[model samples]
Target chain A: MRVVVPVSGSDPKTRLASVLTPDERRDFTDAMLADVLDALTGAGLEPAVVSTAPVDCDAPVTVDERGLDALVNDLLASTVDEAGGALAIVMADLPLATPESVDRLVSTDGDVVLAPGLGGGTNAFVCRHPDFRVDYHGASIRDHRRIARDAGVDLSEVDSRRLATDIDEPSDLAEVLLHGDGAAADWLADAGFEVALTDGRVAAVRK
Target chain B: MRVVVPVSGSDPKTRLASVLTPDERRDFTDAMLADVLDALTGAGLEPAVVSTAPVDCDAPVTVDERGLDALVNDLLASTVDEAGGALAIVMADLPLATPESVDRLVSTDGDVVLAPGLGGGTNAFVCRHPDFRVDYHGASIRDHRRIARDAGVDLSEVDSRRLATDIDEPSDLAEVLLHGDGAAADWLADAGFEVALTDGRVAAVRK
Candidate 1:
């Protein structure tokens, strides 16, 4: 199985602009990408990064400047045409993703395995069927399910908090601080980010 | 490790009453329970059923007439005081749960491993820490997270569609028909329940 981690090397985590400067976002994104790569490697799978621009990582980086939907669709098409093996796509922002969780996502039997994000996005997925493609639009998880159904493929969903969480908003950082133990968590801690409870909700705040 | 599946044999799946009669609901619930037990046993875990009434199954059934929270808390306390081993609680309605998914739930290392349901419920959980208890109220997953945090235990959440999906509503049966290959799915199929698209949503309707 070939695993791919999609990342935006430039201007990543724009939703976190309120809490992070452009440089900090870029650094944090790299940290998260490193954590995801480590998790995939720990799971005994070699992962390559599909970034929008050049990234400094041990994994082989393929800079695809296209939009997410197009990039993923092209990857799916090429995987079908060339390798004809299973392809697993994991978002780079899921710092909480552990090796065990990644194993669960890949080990399950299905033509297409989807890891739906908390906010109705497709955070990660394993595509084993040639017909299955991705559409990363509004509620992409729902769209993926529909697409799988339309393609007449068996779909399995990996319900994992680790995979479901993508660090886009500032509030999402709290989850990384709380449940994460990888490079991203270390970066946040080094940057003086801590978990705080504001209005009965958890948030990551710099102290 | 001890595995316990709590079931309300008296009045189960009341929310599904609109579609099923009392006897049908009882039978359906039993089928789901059977599937859950099969999954647990398949995962090499001996699971006992803690039910409000007698249930005809291969596993040992402990008739506990207490509420869900009380029964689970009491079980947690006993497991701490006597067994000194981990306790895994899997709800009866998760027909989609396969042995692989169950293995992922129990195999993960954490003091408290939570599998949050689709509708803010804690469907299945493995509790290794003595201080961890369950509260099956509104948004119990959130409460469990908070409780684990307060108890200073290492918390791990398993995001699995198989574990997260509990059949409580009529619409939920579509998932069983689609993804489940267990006794519960067979039961629903035998009952002539088929997946129907209603209002752009998948639903289980009788032919």
Candidate 2:
């Protein structure tokens, strides 16, 4: 099984712009990537980083400038040519992910295993069937299920909070500060970001 | 099609005891139940509450003191006798659930449509196949998948944060106050519980 962690090296986590500067977002993205790599390595999987631009990490980084959908679909197609090989794609923004959750996701038996993110995104997936490909656009989890169904393959899902909680909006930073215990959490804390309540809502605020 | 929201009417939300008193826990449970009921009704489905004890709500309440697995299994069996009928079970503690998410859960096509909760519980499910029974023991979502596979039925999952985020621990209260807009959120505010950062972690603290 080849595990791949896809990241956007440039201008990532734009939704967090209100709280994080561009440089901070880039640094925070690296921190999240490091956390993901640590979890994958902890799960005993040697993962490769596939990013839109150059990134510095412990794992081997492949700078694929293509879009997410194209990059992932191409990776899936190449795996199909390998004849009986599995590919696992995990997004890099899941700061709360632990080794056990990633292990459950990969060890599950199915033609395709999907770990759906919050608000209908495919955070991570394991594709064992050659006919299976990915489409990470517009409710991608639902689309993946339909794609697997159309290909006449059995699909399974790993329902995990750690894998589902991708860092997207500014509001999502609170989850990292609360449940995360990785480099991303350390980065946020070092950057003077902490969870705070303002006007009946909990969010990550800079002091 | 029939919709059921199963709630534990006696000493519910025990995990919340650290922050809420016994009476407060009961009241908070009722508020969460009302939120679930409102979401169901808003989705154009008239739902019934099957509880362990008497409860007050807008929907009809049926007190079934049996365990969760037995109660849900019996409900599935009863639905089998209805001849091509479907049953949807949504947990009462999912205060973040919205009407649109519930609508998607039921409207989706599958023998068993599961909305898995965080930490391996099945928060909500729609069963169209008669042979499918539930076991709400350890890792209920995985058990349900195996059960569906053993029965030779297609299982689909709704990977929704709203349905997945069940209010269990005191930390979960922040989610209700953040993303929730129902009676449960109102109850938390009325009870003087607000989101606060304590010891670098976010939690629902009493003001």
Candidate 3:
């Protein structure tokens, strides 16, 4: 399977602006990308890092300035045609992703296997059958279901908390600090980000 | 309007098990209940704390010893019938709720005004129409919408971050710490619950 880990190199994790500086966001994004790449590699799959701009990471980087939905759709079409097998796309914000989780995605038997995000977004997906295009619109998970049904392709859904918990909003940073010990976690630790009692409530802050 | 603040007194916030002890949970629940009551009272509404077990808070406690859906449904049914006006049910976990937000719920013109939680739950709601009822099952917000449509009553959705922010999981403690200066935030602060970096990731922990 040809796996693509998409990262936002230009400006990433904008939702975390409340808790992270712009540079911190980029660094955190790279750290999460590293974690995803490590998991994909540990699963015995060679993955490529696709980003909007050039990102400094260990993996082979492919910079494509296209919008998320269009870029991934194009990548899937070309890769599946050439490889004639499974092609997977994973979001880079999944700091809690593990080798076993990646293995689950590839091992699931279906034309399309999806790991749905908490807000009904498709976090990671494997497209095995030909003619199954991708769409990341509003409520894309629900849209994916309809697209799969119309295409008459089997769709397998993977319900994993680690995969579902993508680090998007500032509130999500708590999950990584609590449950993860990955490169992203290390980056966050180095950056002095922690869950702290700020003015009497629970919050993630740099302390 | 009779405002009912529903709380799970027996085992509240099971999702926060990783961070809070049982006693801490009880205390935090009471603190949040106090915040909700303060908001309701500030809005000139007589609020009652409805719980499965007896709870000590700022409001009058009404122990029903029933499941959440059953108790809230019963309260809404009886209150709507008796008052011949609007009746509201607000979750006890909304420490960030303000008098302004509660007033928005009561003042909204609709048969049923729902304040949807981040997770598909109804955090706060106003039932004005005679036939309008509530269902707090799994994904109950969507169920309530269907119920309203079936009953042919207009449904108003109040989208407020304060109303949407309900402290459920350990990660949720961050919101209260970040934006809340309420009793719940004070309780969390006193309990030593803070967002901190533990071993690399961000987590809400007692130091």
lDDT of each: 0.85, 0.85, 0.78
Query: Per-residue lDDT for B104-157 in model 2, tens only?
Result: 789979999998765556889999998899988755766898999999998887
Best-first order by DockQ:
1, 2, 3
Q: What is the interface RMSD of each candidate, in Å?
A: 7.4, 11.7, 13.4
lDDT tens digits by residue: candidate 1, A151-189 = 999988775767877787776787777667889999999
Q: Best candidate per TM-score, number? A: 1
How many clashes (backbone atoms < 3 Å, residues ≥3 apart in a chain or on different chains) does model 2 have? 0
Candidate 3 residue lDDT tens string, B64-181: 8888777866766777766676788898888988888788778978989988765556788999887877777555666798999999999887645578777887766766765578
Give stretches of model 1 more than 4 Å off: A1-75, A82-124, A127-207
**What ranges in model 2 sit over 4 Å off?**
A198-201, B1-91, B95-207
Worst 10 residues of 1 chain A by lDDT: A195-204
The estimated TM-scores of all candidates read 0.63, 0.57, 0.53
Best by DockQ: 1
